[model samples]
Target: MKVTQIPFQKIGFFSKTMLDYLEKNPKINPFYNNFPDFEGFQKQIAEKQTSFSKSSRLVLAEALKNQYESFEISEKTKTNISLLKKEHTFTISTGHQLNLFTGPLYFLYKIISAINLAEELSVKFPNQNFVPVYWMATEDHDFDEINYFNFDGKKVTWNRKDGGAVGRFSTDGLDAVFDVFSEHLGNSKNAQYLKKLFADGYLKHHNLADATRFIANELFAKYGLVIVDGDDAKLKELFIPFVRDELEHGTSFKAVSKTIERLANNYKIQVNPREINLFYLGDDYRERIIFENNLYKVNNTEIAFSKDEIFKELHKNPKAFSPNVIMRPLYQEVILPNLCYIGGGGEQAYWLELQDYFNAVNIPFPILLLRNSVQVISEKQARKLAALNISKEELFLNQHELITNKVVENTAIETNFKDKKQFLEQQFLDLKEVAKKTHISFLNAVNAQERKQIKGLEKLEKRLLKAEKKRQTHLVERITILQNELLPNQSLEERQRNFSEYYLEYGITFIDVLKIALKPLELQFTILEI
Candidate 1:
């Protein structure tokens, strides 16, 4: 495999807030305590150690031990789970919804980033132990988002009427999905392996959570990736204090609302907080809990509880209360001795709004690291790209811009009017000088005419490019096909394609190639030629 690194901003896939945070802009420093760097980890380690209690650590370890009881995990993963009980151990975690067949290609990248970061951190701090964790978003209720994955330019989906948390969703409908998926995956050794993986993971497993755990562990068990499902009662018990605070004081609302107000001045806020960021969860229902008229009611439901009634319910059944996006991060931090969170652009953006909440709750905020993103191209495709003279940097441009650039490079016609526009403006400079010399009242009029002429030239230049594009339609089509191959639906491959697309071709070595190429702390986009 050959690899190239490009800055995330250059890729045009990240948000301004995420890019700004990565650059460590002083304006963002007030929102987050430490920049995610080597030295930042040192400070975060000290802070997390003081904040994460020993009892919580013990509970977390026991919970993991129970969670992994049935799965045949590697000894390395077992050791990592055992290490969580130690005071010197810290977790580097990345989380995702349980998308079928590991939805997008970035799913692998996110876990790989966490696993690689833990390994790097261990090498840096020899005395400390770092464990990679994949926190399953089992409590997520948005079934549509996690129901399908793209394969062979098609969405292989689990068609079912979904209700409640997706983790608890049955794998019954998945056998049909697996049959459809197997049809697309051609018969090869890798294909057979995938079939068995899907069969054992989904058909044999009882629920989505277990199926996802089996798949992830099958892929990354050798690397010691410990997967955790947060929908456990014992884990919910750890978050009782925050849940109680949210119910009574509306603490996340106060803190996150203020932070959003401040962040809105310079950046777009990803998520707005609710007055109560906890949801009332039932067997087949998960609804937002809204406090109104001194009564807590589940949204769109007849369920209502007074303060005393709700308090009693919470004490008896804390698992019934689920944290929303705002409080979920707090819950994750409270349960694990986590030092850093590895996530995608959107994940990091929302996390930026939470440091104030973490401060208000007096919990140590985990250092947020954007997960490693990769674009993988086959050797044949790489050769085609090279033959077309498309540079790695050129691939990041928007579809239209990339085609226009290539057309300009390939055509003999002058596609750019930049120099001509400059010269025309420079000529207007003399006209303005002449108008000024006469001191005429028509100076503004002269500038207006210049602007009009420039606008006309711009229109004419666009027309010329359009005409040229038609002349080189075949060449343009080739470039379009290439671009579409690299970026499906004009979006990042990692966002559109599934790992199975490559795993069928390269199998297990595909991951090994990625592990070799990905440098977690480098903080750049990776392009891999496989």
Candidate 2:
């Protein structure tokens, strides 16, 4: 296996805000407490320790132990869980939706990034224990987004009706999804392994939350990846104070709204904060809680509570309250003894909107780091790319631009009209000089003529490019085919293709190879060829 690192700027897939944040642009400096690096963790660790109490740590450890008890927890994971009770222990977390079969290739990358970063920090701060955490977005209600995963060009879907927090959704319908997958998987040993894996995860487990926990633990337990579902009573008990504050004063909405306004001056706001960001969770419903008519009302429902009644409800059933996107980060930070957050670009963007809120609530904001973005190419594909004289950088170009450039490169014609334009500019320069000796109107006419001539040259250049493309049809087709393979469906392979597609060929070693290749602190795009 070989690995190549490219800066995110060259990849052109990240947003300007993400790019700037990664580069530590002064504009983004005000939004985050500490920049993500080994040095940055020092200040974050100190701040988190000052606020994270012994009682909170006990609650967190107990919740994790209870969650891990149902599964076959590895020795390393048990140790990591025990370490959470120690003052020297801290967590590095990355949260994700319970996407079926680990929705995209990046899901694995995100967790691997957290694991590798925790390992690095353990070595760096030898006295302190670092644990990698995968916080399951169990309360996320977006069924349409998490119900399907792309395998090769086909979408393996679980077409089922679901409601409430997705974590509680029954896994009874996954058998049909498994049959569809089996038909595509054929009869390889890896396929059989995956079949059993899916059966043990979804078919055997009662709910989506447990199924996802089983699947993630199966794949990553060796590295001691601690999985936590936030929809637990014990965890919510720790967050009750903040939830109450949200209900009383709407603190998060006020602070986050200010930050969003300031952020919108230069960057796009990722998520808008509602007046009350907490939601009321029921058996088959997760509805927003809105304060209106001097009463706490659950959106789209007739259930309403007075201020005193709502406070009593929160104390009795803290788990019944779920935080939306805006408040979820605060909830996670409140419950865990975490130092940094590892996430994708979009996650970081919304997190940026919450720093002011974190400050307002008097909790230390965790350092936000974009997870490692990867592009995997086969050796055969690498060789083909070389034969076409395409560099690694060329692979990142947009589809049309890549094909156009290849067409021009393969054809025996000059597609660029730069020299012609330069010559025309020089002629115009001479004409302007001559017109200067005559009249101002004559110079204006020369300027008009120059514009007309440049427009003509541009038109000619387009026609020549079209002619060259027609002549190099075969070359264009080959390039298109190669690009499509490298970037499936003209999208990033990690975003569209599932990891199982590669696992079939490489087996479990595929994950080991990524663990070896990924450097969470490197903060660059990686291209790995296996």
Candidate with the greatest lDDT versus the true structure: 2
lDDT scores of the candidates, listed in order: 0.91, 0.93
Q: Which 10 consecutive residues of model 2 have the lowest summed lDDT?
A: 405-414
**Per-residue accuracy of model 1 over 391-463 as CA lDDT, tens digit each:** 8988878989988988888888887899999999999999898899775677988989998999999999999
Q: Please state every model's RMSD to the true fold in angstroms.
A: 2.2, 1.6
- Model 2, span 447-524: residue lDDT tens: 999999999999999999988888888888888899999888777889999988998888998999999999999999
- Residue runs of model 2 more than 4 Å from their true location after superposition: 429-448
The TM-scores of all predictions, comma-separated, are 0.95, 0.97
- Name every residue pair that clashes in candidate 2: none
